[model samples]
Target: MGRPSDIPVWRHIGEAPCPPSGQERVTIAIVGAGPVGLAMALEFGRRGHQVLLLNRPDFISAGSKAICFSKRSLDIFDRLGVGDAIVEKGVSWNVGKVFWGDRPDPVYQFDMLPVKEQKRPGFLNIPQYHVEDILFDAASTLSSIDMRFGHEVTNVLPDDDGVDLEVRTSLNSYKVRADWVIACDGSRSPIRSMLGLEFEGRIFEDNFLIADIRMKGDHPSERWFWFDPPFNPGQSALMHKQPDDIWRLDFQLGWNIDRKAAVAPENVEPLVRAMLGPDVEFSREWYSIYTFQCRRIERFLHGHVIFAGDSAHLVSPFGARGCNGGFADIDNLGWKLDLILRGEAPASFLETYDEEAIVTADENIRNSTRSTDFITPKSETSRAFRDAVLELAQDFPFARPFVNSGRLSTAISYPDSGINTPDMDRWVGGVAPGSPVIDVPIGNRWLLDRLGNRFVVLADGWQGPAPDGVEIIDVGIAAETLQLIRRRFDFSPGAACLIRPDQYVAARWRTPTPALVSDALRRARGLA
Candidate 1:
């Protein structure tokens, strides 16, 4: 990998050469300082808990890694107070075009943002390094967050009451006792390995070469995908424009190629030049070859030790599920851990985090596996079917659904979660009890912006008193906006919804008594 002079580098205030330290005690210890680890530290820090964030690298990070971030990710970042900053620097996009062979025009095109009038765009493309920099900067403002950049965890030993960790630096090793430990390391998690856990899933045989090059590209911000293109025959290709004049390109390379030689500058130059055209000028910044895999550990929570982000699950880069899924993990686990720490919820409450996150990981695996199969067919019959579907997808609306470039990451509903209060009334069209809340505008502000990180009652002129400690969010708006909210939330007169701290609906009803709302609140807190 090569770094250009254009990209900015970030150094943390706590970054320094490693020397020995004395033993210490902390409330929570988070391993890894990538986007997920830093976000995890921020999640706990904002909840008024002391956290120790550890990373192996001296600097934040470099190169073009995990650039595509989904809408759900933006919402999480917004809650963390860095959403506006990310959107300002990222390349926002909504439309995507799919091409077959050397066709002059795209056979089918689609909009990623199906719903209208949302606060954020459908997707944003910014280098992963920028995301880490922003998250670290936000975490620095919190007194509860203590970040160490050049530290590594040598061992993790869980006892009856808490976990003891051995941390190593350049000169010496020291111990830290933590009531709770969070693992946010990359896919190759050192924490998971030390705990003797293993992932279970399939690793696809196909390979893809990624090339990030700088150039004055004519391509629009929209994502462009091609199948069996002339530049790379019998395979698929993808292209996206980043914030800088950098263009990211991916070319399919079958299983049996030399991984080392494939990334050589001499070999990678021809591929980019051929794809761009004979006269195009460009400079390469990075090149790599990699395989795809969909795998996850069986459980995310183990006693006082928990795993999140790439350490918990992994998905192919096609749908941008990698980092987006990580944000989802933080959103789900943060509130639950906060309640448990305060003794408001039992230890068993953390098990739900294990269940819900596994559900999310499994769903992403199933959908991403399907997309991989469509992009890289396994046999002649499958390839023929895929091509036929692509041919008909251009004109036939029916065939469009069968074409699986990627399912594009979305917030999944947890219908079977134990904490969800099952709906007791008939509903028409609204966010369900276990679904993610829909974003709507209220006056000049967005609906989500008003709902802070706490349990609230979203009522529609219900006049019913909410349970203790639960606040009622304002939904009063202009007639047009009110109508939109009513439609999206099915909030007829007297309808009420109970939303959890993580912005997920716990329960809803058309008409409810005070007793019922109390029961739902208790149930959502894992006390019922």
Candidate 2:
């Protein structure tokens, strides 16, 4: 494919001598250079694993694809060393307003960042290209990540012990063996097709036009959604503010519209002018018509090959679940894959990745499906119900919950996973097994910064020494700190909680013993 004349080309820094045939072996082979693949590379690189990251394209992405980054994704980026840059470059927003047809007032408004004290904002809006650049820069600086741009994977063969890949470059074709292969190739993954994997789910007939424009406007940095608005009659519209004066607009075009004509400048300009006044000057950055689907493969793990991000599952773009869920995949798979590669954990531990990620994908599909159904009613009765909800939402506070513009992606809680230790003692509202650690401030640093990438034993004022391979955190040193800890963890003096490397709580006890802690660690690591 030829590059667009107007788009700027990113420099390629992956030029190097090709490896000799049949002799190259890496601990891991990643099949894409998008956000998920780059993140996988960065995580493994940081852990000192031999990694090869392959991409078919030599240049970076030209336009913003995934614009919304959730707080949980930011936390993952922070752990990978690029969180601050993303936060600094993206437009942070926590408030959203939803309006009904031609009404001068909003029917409902929501605040995503309800709490004042937190490490990251509720979400940020930035072009996906910027995120790729940051991850690419970080990946290039690592010694363990071998980035091979313009190298395409032609075939893959998985075996009991490892996988063999046939790759083609402009110069030559070569074969490489890897202990593990990760397919981050994308929704139209060739690896998936080659492996005869099937993605099963519902495909919505509704089409939407996405336009990114650069303009100077008075619109505040918040999400504004319209249900049957004046600008686009009888359909829903969404507008969001992004960094660099770029604004994203999505206009729903019922399935019958011609996609090519919808994205044409002649048609798109009139829509933009209608929405943003005829006098406002703006230039189009990018435009595309997309049909969304809520789909996923039955399994994410296939022998020695694993799939992440779009290659594993896909969701409608309403709730920003696609990228956020992909980040979750990276977080869940990174440590587990690393441990397995280093022989610290058995290969069967990967079954937990499949179990947990499937649960996450299902949650995303459910929310995205609901949002799609509400936005595009399939029948007259459904439309009437939706309109009725919107109408009542203007006056009745009770009707507001029925409005589902988009739930906005948030962390999914895994309370009943097999890895978690069941509660044996009476406890009130607090972090439980399989729950991500809540962030809290300690003196000058945050609680997350103090926790290591291993098993952690957090205690209020316990004097007993922790078992081997466990890091202890004394939460009772300061009165104010102790108060915050107790409120978050529902803890009294001497209570302890065991936290996993991914920051999920594994177990808690009023009084912990070495035997109990060790057993909990074993269960959490899938060794039990």
Per-prediction TM-score = 0.96, 0.96
What TM-score, to 2 decimals, does candidate 2 have? 0.96
Which clashing pairs does model 1 show? none
Residue lDDT tens for model 2, 1-528: 223355465555543457865668888999999899999999999989989998877677676589999988888888898999999999999998999988888898988777556788888998888899999999999999999887888999999999999988778888999999999999999999999999999999988989899999889989999999888999999999999999999999889988889999999999998888988799999899989898999999999999999999999998899999998998899988887887878999999999988989999999999999999999999999999999899889999989999988887878888989988887898898888888787666777767745678988876557777677888865456668778888988778899987778999988877788888888988888
Q: Rate the local accuracy (lDDT) of all candidates.
A: 0.86, 0.87
Candidate 2 residue pairs that clash: none
**Which sections of candidate 1 miss by over 4 Å?**
1-22
Top TM-score prediction, candidate number:
2
User: How high a TM-score does candidate 1 get?
Assistant: 0.96
